[model samples]
Target chain A: MEVQLQSWQNMKLAQVPHMLAGHAMPWVLAARRSAFERFAAHCFPTRREEEWKYTDVSIIGRRSSLAPDHIPPDPSSEAKLLAWTLASESLYLMVFVNGHYAPGLSMTDDLPAGVRMASLANILENGADLPESYFDPQHEHTIFAALNNAFATDGMVLDLSPGTVLKAPIYLLYIASGHGVAIYPRNIVVAGEDAQATVIEHYMGTLDAHNFTNAVTQISLSAHAEIEHCKLLQEGPAATHVAGIHAEQASDSHFISHSFALGGRLARNDITAQLLGKSCHCTMNGLYLLNERQHLDHHTRIDHLAPECISREYYRGILDGESHGVFNGKVVVHPGANKTDAHQANHNLLLSRQAEVDTKPQLEIFADDVKCTHGATVGQLDDDSLFYLRSRGIDAELARSVLIYGFTNDIIGRVNMPELRTRIEHLVLERLPQGDQIKELL
Target chain B: MLTIKNLHVSIDDNGNGKEILRGINLNVKAGEVHAIMGPNASGKSTLAQVLAGREGYQVTAGSVRYLGQDLLAMTPEQRACEGIFLAFQYPVEIPGVSNALFLKTALNAMRKQHGLPELDAMDFLSLVRERMKRVGMDEALLSRAVNEGFSGGEKKRNEILQLTVLEPRLAILDETDSGLDIDALKLVADGVNDMRSPERSIVLVTHYQRLLDYIVPDVVHVLSQGCIVKSGDANLARELERHGYSRVETENTAKQVA
Candidate 1:
């Protein structure tokens, strides 16, 4: 609880002096007036708050005390950051530096006929936008998201025409290179009726620069529309990340979101999916691997607001060294949402004796006729399985490494995108302590 | 080629222990198959586990020599590299790993330990295809996760396929015939028979004589109270099948005096 005050009262306002002197145009400054006011009224949440009890952001706030510098990153470091991308021939790559759209690093080709990809600045300047009804306050549940809304400079926007089938996926990469800085980025996606596309948001750092990234993404899918959204978080070690994703699925629409967390000193993701139309389906899957003194948290909510909607969620974590992981998933079925089917599961594998995992899967059903189940498991590797492999001539240490890889690989393998799947596999393998043992595996 | 001298094993870490493998002695040379048959609670499986160097069993007194080398002194992988294989009654399911890939890694590990070239993908494919046909396994099974969602028969067949790929000099099958139908038993037996060679040895541990009917052993040993009380040709298996294990144990005591 003491840590909460440090992160909120002191660190939240420390950057105000530095930010006020920062450069911005008159029109852009005018646009952010309301956002800055909203941020001032609502500060960071304390540990006493039920939603933030398990995760203390005070450590992150202390780290964010140093103001972010606007100086662009070096060319060599930018090349290294782009090297981690696994984009394919059909992907339209959009790159960002210091949370601002970087046109020089981005590549645009093979775009669909009725699809638009533009920066938030351009959208604001040209007056293009999503329906006003889609915008809602999510920061009431997460104070960091409100901070992101308050400081967001610019972001990416996607607009699809009805009945358009995108042949290639859109790749959005976010890079941070400044030292002791904070960057807020936002992404808005709208899928017209009967449209289908896949979007990949990748995060990486150009240098070992100490920084903070606060991001918010809002997605709205029309009836009969489908969207596959995947986020990859592989930030720098000294960095802190706070991200929130809000998705609204209409009747006959399908939305799938996959989050892979493998970065930062402290990271937390808040994901919400609201099924507002009948026969809608939403699947949320996530995998997190942490080591060193890192802390990672995931809070997911699925609201079954309409009848006959189905939702499935599975989140897995592997904590090593002195790391900590937390999972809090809740499925809410409102009244009159009969025939709703929802399932949530969280599984954690603790590698070291000192590693810890806190998991809670909650299911609250108000409808009379609905099926809901939730379970959480935290345990070490199976001794029987390990012995089975050792008895076959594999060394005990190698056997443990293989089992660990196989455990997390199940979730990574669930990704339908082939290139992205392979990239995540490589990243996961590289992050393991016994990465050398897996060279033979690949 | 294996020799066990006064082999004794005890379960549990307790120092004041009840010995599982009492003073037992056995010897077998190349070009022969030996079957160890016993009732439930007997130490037939313990003997196989000890020979494979699995943990959790304390060897109070014993020395085992395999092909003129100290078997118990070597690590599990070392024994594997030296051509020792165990076909488990219940194979472990390894998810997210393809059958072909798992086999290739195991095969290459053994090959590398033996100073041989690692088998490439095409070479492994050719080798697996032949083994699959002999085991009556569908070729498509190799692309799926190892033993995951596989039928009982398929799992057994997959075990046989791995055995064929490894081709160890000594194979100790720990109740491989425990869970199988008549057709599956025949297919598995055929796979074992095809693997038989003049320079290789086999030890089949089973509670029933059905497996011996297909792959007849050169010798059948009856293990009772952690010791071998009777040893004879394949006829011992048939007699025990007809008279039951209790009758055999009593008869062995009587024959000891005669």
Candidate 2:
């Protein structure tokens, strides 16, 4: 705990509120002056706070010593960080080095007509006038989100033309580099009316690199628009990754988000979707596999503001070694959101005796006629199933691993993208404690 | 070959030291099909369960010898590896496990324990395709989850299909014919008949003689009050079918037949 606090404090120089005022966000920093003042009036939540009770981020608070007055020139860590980005052949790649866009590695030539994809810095310098309206005006300094807003030096800015459908996925890689370095990478995606597209954000780092990633991404879907957004975070084991995703859905729009987290010593992912229009739909799915003293937490909130909107969420986790996992989900049905159909479930498989899980699935319904259900379960492999397998001559250890993987496979098999699914399967199997024991079985 | 002598069994879960098998005795040689007929609560299934080494059934006093080994001493899996198989009365539906995959795993496990080379996936598929035909089971059934979404008859045929694949030395069919139509009964009987060999034996547990009419066991024994009260050839099954258990008990009790 002390180690984590020290790490947090060391990151104070790169803190969101201070860094925002110091960097490219001067206009936003000035526009949200009162909000920033309100942010400063309240400190980050501690363990005593009920929302943060199960997870302790004080270790992040302790990393004040690592903070630097200014970003280092020619950061020695950029090379290793760039090499870890997913370089799949089919993806239209956009790379960010130390939170700065590196156009040298980007290949965005064949983007569909009327699509706008550019670095935030380019948009700001080329008289694009994104203005303060693009920034989340409703967001107060949320500590981490404010920190990301303050220090976001380079981010992907995407705007789709009305009724345009992109055939290929847009890949954005946010790489955090340098020892004791901290980065806040922000992304803004806006889809015009009747547009459809898929965007994937990759948060990655090199092996053993000590850094912090505080990122915020917002996606806006207009009337009749559809979007599929995915986030894959596989940072270095010594790194701390905190992210917030906010989505606003318009009339008859649809949004699907999948988040996969497989790295970092401490990681927390927060997602909030506001269904503001009638007949809008939102689906959220996540998979997290943690081992070897890792801590992973997922907090999701879905708000149905209009009638006839539907939201569904499913999340699964595999915890091994002494790792800890936390899942907190809430589905909110507003007064006018009658006939809202919302379902949320969180299931965890603890592979080791010391592994632990804290799960809370909630439904806050104001509309009486809505159908809302939520459930959370944490358990180990069924011993009867294990014995049944062992009776078929599978060794005890192999039998247990098979059942555990099979339990989590229910979610993995749902991932329709073959390559991503295969890669994730390998990653999950690699992190399992006795994964080798089940090789023959697989 | 399978042999049981003076077997005594008891269940102690409910704090009642009640005996389920009261000094029962039975013998079965290779190539023999012996049917144990009894009413409900007559300890018929208990005898089959004891032979399969199911947990929680205490063998208070008895000796069971299979292929000259201490059958009572072997674990369920060990008993399975040594060619002992039990076709459960109510097959458990494993939601995500495929039937063919399950049978392949069971077959390969037995083969591995016997020091035989395991079959490849293609070989296993071919083997399963052949055995399923003998049981008159639909080939499509293999692609489904094990017994999940299966009808009662499909589950019964699946058990017989397993019997045909494992080819255990002693097959204990625990009421395998309980919930079956006439067509399904013939298929199950055909499956059992195909597995009969000079080196294999079988113990069929049932409460009715309808199954016997199709399978035609070599011997039939009336099990009443936890003990065998009568033993005879195939004609005995026909007699019970004609006169019913009460009449058989009367005719046999009057003679004090063993």
Candidate 3:
């Protein structure tokens, strides 16, 4: 297993020196060096680890020398890139191709006043914040997070000032098109006091473009601030996706995350949030649809570190064919965090006999006066529910599609953005039978 | 409107057939109301399920004809579009599917089958609002997920609401009187009475004669095991209420021996 995972260690540091030399900032070099040491020390996780027991990433570890290359963007690659893009003209769009900023394809010129938004590489190369404050790396980092920090070439950074409110969401599209390409995107969002922003990140690739994408994002929300982060991972059919998101919310702040994993042969996402102040509200909603030989796992945790905080988590999955899906949710109400109200539920619908799901809910309540409830259910379409709908005049196929659509729409409905929700609905529809006809039913 | 001959029904348990209905025979004319009374596990619900084309039950030997067509050969939706409606004993709850959307879709699907144009949102809302008044149901329930979090009486009222909205020619009400109080029962009965016309027929499946008091049935049949042992006018339900099923069973067995 060590040898198989040594694919990253076996890769020459040649590409790193070249990428680092472009950004002569000493802190940039220092951060990269420390991250590399951490990455080397921890190595890749295996099935033996409790947090990753259900997700086996040996397939990713076996990749031969996973590193990004500056492949010249061709006309067809650009076309393919645009096909997977989810940004509208009304929103600010940033496109990163092959782990480097594609300035010609980006739409960041319309940023409002007091907004400090740029790519990480550009921030390091030109002039930027202090090294210690630029990247707020958590003390306890996973191997994948360390790897992303050490090797990422470019990523979106939205450093909003106090009282700044983004009228529209900022969209970031990251594409890994070239074969054998591995894109490590390290995104950071620091929302100051009373600031509000919505950040939409989409990781995508063509159907046959084999690649690996390891993304790490850290978000810090100040008092009274609100941040909604939505991510859609729709990579190629043979791609591997491993992502980690950590958020810290202050007093009276609101942080919401919506994660949709619909593609890739192997994918795993770990999202955690800490309610660090009184009256803080945090929500984590996710939906994953997998079929064929694809496998997806979602691990989510919410810690109520302050009194009288509220946290809610809801995740649903639709598994078909021979695919495998896993949902593990944990909500912890720390000691003295009294009056903490936490709720978590995970439900899955299996469409085929060969499809499988592993679901579990872990709730820890150390506080004496707290309300925490968690439930996990894995099942096929309810036979009675199906028959009830069918006993009406609805056709058999349309009834089936409507039930599936309703199952996923439960999560998508919480998105609040109609445009993003509609697009996500379309992506989910493509996986259903006669899904096009469901538009009429809706 | 309906004809049943030698209706022998059974459910498949593993590989063997567990019989529920044995060699039953009956006929129902248009514009008539018939009440079927029996004890628990007497195959009353199975009969309604089979009529509605529900799965998990097999007609080992039987023939059911509806409007001169073989009712057993139709799918549930096909039967529904063809004017067959069954009010389930335990109404199913469908989360995430609002009652308004479900009712609109169902009504439109039936209308499309009949070559009629579909109703828009406003028109459908008006129609449902009017029907909700007749069924004594809350208008707020239309926006809620179907049957979810509904009380037992509310679920029964919802079933009656669907019967009124769909306006099927033949309605089979299976145990619609079980979960309702007297007030709700009268309201539900009035909803059914409103739909009663010269072209429609109603089949009431109940254990007590109480529901028949509100909506009187022209005739009543007593099913003892898998067969209708004896039948008479509405008085038969009154007699069964006083004597219970054991007396009727004894008399039925004596008659069989004779």
Give the top-scoring candidate (DockQ). 1
Name the top TM-score candidate: 1
lDDT of 1 at B210: 95
Q: Any runs in candidate 1 off by more than 4 Å, and if so which?
A: A1-31, A64-68, A75-88, A125-140, A433-442, B13-16, B254-258
Q: Distance (Å) between predicted and true CA of A186, model 3?
A: 2.0
Q: Is the docking of candidate 2 incorrect, acceptable, medium or high quality?
A: acceptable
Q: Please give the distance, in angstroms, between residue A154's alpha carbon in candidate 1 and its true position after superposition.
A: 2.2
TM-scores of the models, in the given order?
Answer: 0.93, 0.84, 0.91
lDDT of 2: 0.77
Residue A136 local lDDT, model 1? 38
Candidate 1, residue A283: CA error in Å?
Answer: 0.3
Q: Which residue pairs show backbone clashes in model 1?
A: A68-A181
Rank order by DockQ, top first? 1, 3, 2
lDDT of 3 by residue, B1-258 (tens): 999999999999789999999988888889999999999999899999999988898899989999999999999999999999999999998877789878988998899999999888888989999999989999999989899899999999999999999999899999999979999999999998998888999999998999999888888998878899888999999998899988999998998899
Evaluated on chain A only, model 3 obtains a TM-score of 0.94
Candidate with top lDDT is: 3
Per-residue lDDT of A77 in model 3:
56
State the interface C-alpha RMSD of candidate 1: 1.7
In candidate 2 the C-alpha lDDT for residue A153 amounts to 60
